[model samples]
Every structure is written in structure tokens, then in C-alpha cells.
Target: MHAGRDASDTLAALLADWQRARTPYRADAHDELAAVLVLAGSNADVERLNLAARAIRRQAGELTGPDRLYRLPGGRTLALAVGDHVRIRTNDYRARKSKGARADVLNGYRGTVVAIEADRSVIVQWRRPGADGPALATEKVSAVYIAVGGLSHGTAMTVAAAQGLTADRMLVYGMGLDPHTPYAAMTRDRLSAHLYLPRNVLESDADRARHSAPRNGAEELHRALNAYAAILQGDRADQLISPEPEPIAAVRARQREAAEQAEVQKMAQAVFAAAMLETVTDPRRPHGLLGDDQLQERISAAAAQTTALAKVVEVEQRRERQQAEQVTAVRAQVHAELAGERDRLATALTALDDAAHRHDAAQDRLRTAQRKVTALEATLHERYGGRIRGWLPSGERARLTEQLQQAKEKLTCAARRAEAAGRAEQAALRQAVEVFPAAPSAAELHQRLRVLANPRTFASALEKESAARVEAVLPGLADQRRVRAARMASPGLGDSAADRQHRARQALAALTAEADYRHRLDATRQRGEERARRDPAAPALARSRHEQAQQQAETRRRAREQQRGYRPSTPPGITAEGPRQGYGR
Candidate 1:
């Protein structure tokens, strides 16, 4: 059993020395603490080192909570808890070693915490394996209590303070000095007074006796210091010291400024209201509120203006009405004048109508007279050698007088012939009377002759008849022959039997002569009339008339040909007549 304990102790020391050498002070302590804690055996010392290592690792931002695992350089791992043994480098002892010193003071060395310090230092019992014993046996052993200062000490102190540990002075091995004072504890006054000591004096056997006389007393003192440091560290951690009171003061000042602004706004609103009231009370503008006097004055002015405008409108309207009336009056006057003119025109028209009727009557009478004169002239011309001019001008009247003289002579010759016929009739009547001087009524005379003559005696008596009777009978008989002869001479009657027998031979010849004479007379009269209407001396106009006559003659010839059933033969080499043929032929 003693051998086993010695082997365990030697192993713990070697592991601690390896940790310190690998991670010196000013280097990260977390790795060093972790290595030592894992190497420590399952003893009270190992348990305490593990806890202290955890705190140091946490402060160095390595090991965190109880659930976190620590990894060693050789791949060994362990969970951290409270009260685990650990090894850490001493910051004060690093300056004492020579540059080339080959001593392995850190190698194979380990420490134990007797008590925790407020400054994150540990009261450690260090041991290394001795050459004369088993590996677990503690060959070299020492006890030192240490505190850290400056950046290195500050980091460790910050963690120890959080864990309720306090320390002002510390003993460190392998540091240039055995005991190091925390910068927080040393003042400028002490340094200026040269209140300094060597590591031997400060951490000597005599000083250790003075400082460590009562071990429990030192422990109690550390506990008291830890309580105070815990309070201070808590205040720093929560940032509670200066921020709380200053926040309240800032809130109060902000509230005051807001109130002052509200007061200023209230004054501005009052000023605005006052200005609005002033505007409302003004009177020069029509929209503003008016005082009583101003209102009355405006009303009076408006009334006067309205009256003046109404008068002007009325005057303009009256002028327009007057103009319209004038136009109507002018139109009426013009219409009246036109009506008067129309009446005068009607009277004149009536007068003209009467005069026209009278003129027409006179014209009708003149036409009647002229027609009578024309009839007389025609009668005179026919009976008097075609020249009678009683109604003609003087020169024409002279020619007509000659014609009248010739007509008168013809009348005288007709009278002489009529007288000769009268004489012949009278002579015959007288001879009859003379021969029948004793003539009974003619019937009685005829009866006497019938009685006197007998058949045998009549032949003898016919010779002896009275001369008076023969004269009377012979004259009457002769007158009867003349009448018969005169009847034969009339054109309307046929010749007597003797004459008819003789005239039958001459009838056609006489009819031909008569027709020829009548035709010649009609032709001569037409020519005379045409010559009087159209003078042959006017050859230009005459040629036109001749052509017109030729056209008429041609029309008559064609009519005659049609009546005679005549048709012209087609000309040689002509198939049908064209328009050219109508003109040329």
C-alpha cells in the first residue's frame, strides 16, 4: 500500500510539471489547468484541483459549466467539477531563471490548494518525485501560497472573485520572485517610498512563520476576503453600480422638456386665435364681420346703386320699345300709300277698257264698209272689161273711167239688139191685124173656115180662101216657127229635129273647141294674177319663186303620174335609189 501511494504521488507531480511547462503564465492557463486536473488521482487533492482548474479555465474562456468536457494534449479527457487539484505557472518567478538554464524546475512538479484566495491565488503544497523512492513517493516537497496581478493576475482574479475567493499577497514557485504583490493592492505612494523587499525576505522561512503561524486563522481571513470580493465582483458582472440612478435622471429631464414644449404650443394657439378674431372684425372687406354703422352705410349704398341700375335698364328698354313702334308706324304708312296707288291704277284700267271697247266697235264698222267696196269693185270689173275704180285714187280713177266708157258702149249695143227684136214682133202683129181687119174673135174665124171647107170642095176652096184669113193664119204660123228656131239656137237646148240630124256630125268638134277656149282663158287669168303679185323684173326673188313653182309642178306631175297608174323604169346600173339620188334625180 505504501508503494502504491508513492507511485500515485509521483505520477501526479509529473503531470503537474508537464502542464506548467506547456502553458507558462501570460500563455493561456486553461490548457495547463485542464492537463493537471486530468492527471490528479481520485483523491481529495485531485477533487480540489479539478474545481480550481474549472474556475481558471472558465475565466480564460476554455472550460465552461459542469457539463463541459476537457481534452488533454495526449487525447485524455475528463469532466470538470468542484475541488479538483491543478497546477498553474507563477507569474513572479519567470524573471529569475538564466537564459540558458537547463534546470527543469517546472517538470515533474505539482501543487495543492490549502485554501482559495480572493485574488485567484492558491495556497499550494508542491511536490516532485524523489530519486530514492518509488514514483508515487514525494521526494521533493514544498508549500507556497500565490496571488496573480497585472493582465495575467487580473484574468485569474476576475475568475476567483466570481467564485468567492480573495488574496492580496501570493507565493509563487519558478517565478523571478517568490512572493508577488497584486498591482491593485500596491499604491504609487508605497512604490515611490521604495517600500520593496527581495523574494527571499518576503517569502523566507521567518516570514512564512510570521504569515502562517495559525493556519486556520489564515483560512478564516481568506473566507472573509472572499465574501467581500464576491459582492464587488457581482456588482461588476451585472453592471448595476452606476447605470440605475442615471437612467431615472434622464427620464425626468425628458419629461420636463416635453412639458415646456406643450406650454409653448398653447401660447402659439392663443396667438393664432387672436389673429383670426382680428381678421373677422375687419370691415373694409365684404366678407368680414361688419359693425352696425358700417352695415348701415353699405346697405344704403347698395340700395342707391340698385335704384340707379333699375332706372338705366328702364330707360334702355323704353328706347327699344319706341324704336319698334317707329318701325311699325313706317310700315303702316307705306302700306297706305301702296293701297292708294292700287286704287288709282284700278280706275285707269277701267277707263282703258271702255276706250278699247269703243275702238273695237269702230274697227268692226270700217271692216264692213271696206267689204262692201271690195264687192262693188269685183262686180264692176267683171261687167266692165275688168277695170272699174270709183273708189280708187285719181290716177287709177282715170283708167277706170275709160273702162266704164267701154262698158257703157257695150250696154248700148245690147240695147240696140233688144230694140230690133221688139220691132220684128210688132211688125208681125200689125200684119196679122191688117189681114184680119173684120176678124171675129180668133176662135170664130177658125170655125168659119172649118164650115166652109168640104172634102171635094176644100181642095177647090183652099185656093179661094180669103186673103185676110190666110194673112192672119200665116203670120201666127210664122211666129211659131221663129220661136222654134230661137229655141234651137239656145245652147242649153238641143237643135230642132232637122238641126239635130245635121248637128250630130259637128258635136264632138264643137265640144273640143269650147273646152280649149275655156282652158286658155283660165290659164291667161292665173298668169295675170301671178304676175301682179310677183314681179318678173326682180330676178333674184323671181328665181326663188320659180324654183318653188317648179317644186309644186313636180309634185303635181307626180300626182298625175300616180293617177295615171304610171311607174318609172329602174335606171341601168342602179340597184336602189339613195339620198344622193333623191337630190340629183
Candidate 2:
């Protein structure tokens, strides 16, 4: 079996065996059709090998009959010669084209091309499907059907297609795809299965030649062999999920259970479900279970159904019209409210703007007054340069002091004006908030309107909707009736007409509560959708004048620093706090 040896080892052994036998691949060597099979991994290799086989036979003058070229599955052309192997690729021949021939030339059936007809249709001696026996039927396949990509050159079949083939010797190439593929390929021979794989192993590594250079051929082969082996044998499955080996008795018991389940299924389908089992109470009824048809009654039923459908369509149209009218009214109200609020907000904002202007003007005047006081202080200091505080003129000091007090008074008046303007701005802002308010979010709006498209079961067609409700409610009623029947256990005492009416009323009450709850949920969602509003205006006035106050204070501090650089500056009490604190406060 070539056990414990790889394809390369087998190939080397094959070469040694061939040399020992001294048999060559000459045209005369296979005169009696040598008992050998050539297999490949791909269609391209198969096509090439098949053509070589055909040419060898032709050179030997064995196949003298004319041949016809036909297309193979993978866009390759194959010439079918007498005594050449061919495999049927489809079951279409059995589908209406041929009768007795159809049954024989099934898919995967290997055959020999016996004759080529004038119309290019070929007569093939076909083997029975899945059989290893010799060809049992000779069928004339249509040229039109043969033109289909269904006929392939089978002289050199792929390892995938060599499953049904068995010969004295088999030579397989380029089929190291998986362990199963090579295993299946190698095991198809009665005598020897020779596999040929490259020794370098780099040849097996697809696209590796472009990107990779092996540091050491031996090392690369060693590494690449492991990966190649993995590709050949995916997911090593040596260990069982149970971790314990199943006993023979347990295995038999599990198989027995499976068999028993199969038998039970067979009984369920085959034995229990006969036509006799489908008997109805009345044998006179048409189709037994299906009740007898009444001519006038059936026609009336159809007419009534059509009228109901017409009513439902009318109801849907009226509902759409009413919803449109309601939406139009609500949208008009929303626009009107939006316009009124926007106008009020604009008026209030304009007032706030005016107040802000007045506040800014008052601040400017206070700053000017403070600057004048600083100038007077600077002039006094310059006029009396290098003078001691006691030597300075009392008249000039009194004059500077009076001017500082006057400036402080003016600042106080400006501060009062600013404070009044701030009050006015605040009043305007409050009025704006009261008039415009914030826009209506879904949560805040008083949503009394609902715009819902309920399901057909609970919508405008009340009568039709009731049919569905009854259908739903009856099952529950039946369950209750069944429970009562079980409790009573009498001859139909629990299922009387009055009792049925009572039970139906209880079901109706429950349905009414549930329907009401659903309506409330739908209404809530619909109202939320209906409560849309436009964005509101939020214009803010520049109310706080503290930034200007800080600037003025900094300006005054710089002025005092300049005055100090010259001579005795004015008194700190009058320059720093007298006018500044009056307005800054």
C-alpha cells in the first residue's frame, strides 16, 4: 500500500520499478491497451495528457477512424477518437432525448467513443452509472447535445473523477491538494499507485518564487513541508470530544436507537397516514372532509365578500380625507401661533437693544469723566515737580480735590443711569420670555390631536375588524370551554348555548380592555408626532458693563504710574477710590 511513504518516495520507487521492468512509453508498448491509468489534479493537465494519449494511439495506426472536436467544460476543445475514454458530464440525455440510451449514459458514466456519425454526433459504448463493469450500452448521442460542455476527454481523468476507475497500475500527478484526494487517487489501483511530487517543495508553494528567497533550501523544505502537510490534512482530528472511547456495547446501543428512530419515522409516514385514516363523519360530502358545495349559497357568499371589500376600500378613503383635513387645520394653527410668538419676541428684543445702547453710552461718559480727573492730577504733579506734599500750594491741592469730588459725583449719576438701563433691559428680557417662551417640544405640548394609522385589525373597518377580533378571541374561549368541560365531565353540560353566550361576553370584555389599552398607546405616539414646533429666537443684550469698568480701572492705574514717575503724585485716596468706587460698585 506504500504505507508510511510520501508521494516523492513513491515516485522514486516508481522510477526504480520502471527501470527494473525496462518497459518504455512507446506507441507499440500499449498495443493491447496497457492496464494503466493516468490521473491529474486539474482540467488543463487532463486535457494535455488526453491529447498526448490520443496522438500516441494515432501514431501507432490503431485508431484509423475519423474524429470530431468538441468543447469541454473549461473552454477547452477535445477530439473524441475511437477507443478513446469519455465521461458523460450531465444527466440531460435521460430527460427526454433518449429512452433506453438515456438510462445508460447518466452523469459520471465512463464510455468509449465507438463511432463518429456524419452529423458529428457520436455513438458511445457507455458503462453503467457507478459501475466498474465494461461498457453495457452503445448509444448514439446527438451532435447538438454533444456541443454542450457535457463531454470531456476521459483518457487522462482528474483524480476527482478517477474514483470509479481501477487498473493494474495508476500514475497520479499534481494531486497533493488534500490527504483525502491523494489517498483516494493512490488507492484506485489493483497493483501499484505511483504519485509524483517535487523534491524541492518550493515548486508546491504557489506565488512564493516572486516574494520569497530561501536562506537554506533544506530549512525551507523542512518548514514548507509542515505547511503543505497541513493543507493536505486539514484540522487534525485525533481526539474525540467525549475524551473517553465509546464501548462497543454503547456504540451498538446508539446505532440501535438511530435505527429505531428511523423505523418510527417510517411508521409515521407510511403506515399511519393512509387514505383510510382520512375518513370524515359524512361519506356523502364531496372530497369527504371538505363540505358539499351549494350553488346559490356559494354565489351569495362571494357577493357578500365583494361588498365587504368595497366597504373597506371606501372606509379607508374617507379616513384618509379626514386625516388630511385635521392635519391641515393643526398645521395652520401651528403657523399662526409661531408667527405671533416670533413677532412678540422681535419687539421685546428691539427694546432690549435700545436699553443696551443707553447703558453703553452711560459707561462711555463715566470713562470720559474719570480720564479728565486723571489729566488734572497729572497737570498738578507736573506744575509742582519735586515739591514735598506739605510745600505744595493748598489752593492747587484744594482745586484738585474739588475736581476729583465733582468727577465722583458725575460718575454716581452715570452709575444711576446705567443701573436704570440694566433694569429696563432685564424687564424687556422677562417680557420676551413670557411672550415667546421656548418652542414646544413633544413632551411639553398639550397634545390632544392624534394622527395614527392603526392596523387593519383595529382600524376604520369596524365590522371587518370585529371578524378578526372574534377569530382571535374564539381560541381563548375554546380553551376556557375545554377547561369547563374537563371540570364538568358530563354529557355537554359545560358547552350549553347560554354558557357559550356567557363565555363569549367575558371574552368580549377582556378584548375591549385590551383594545382600549392599544388605542391609548397608539394615540400617545401619534400625538407626539403631531406636536412639532419651529425654533424660537433667543437674542441676548450686553447687560453686564463690568468689562468696561475693569478697563477703565486699568487705564487709571497706568495714568497714576506716569504721574508717580514725574514728582509727588496726587493723593491716593482721591485718585484711586473716589471716582472709581462710585461707578465700579
- lDDT of candidate 1 over 336-434, digit per residue (tens): 543443354344334434444555555555555555555555655664443444344565555655655655555555455445544544444343334
What TM-score would each prediction reach against the true structure?
A: 0.18, 0.30
Error of 2 at 556 (Å): 99
Worst 10 residues of 2 by lDDT: 533-542
Stretches of model 2 off by over 4 angstroms after superposition: 1-35, 71-75, 92-103, 127-135, 199-585
Any idea what lDDT model 1 has? 0.37
Runs off by more than 4 Å, candidate 1: 1-302, 319-323, 336-375, 378-585
- lDDT, candidate 2, equals 0.52
lDDT of 2 by residue, 527-568 (tens): 321221110110111112334556778999999998777653
Q: TM-score of predicted model 1?
A: 0.18
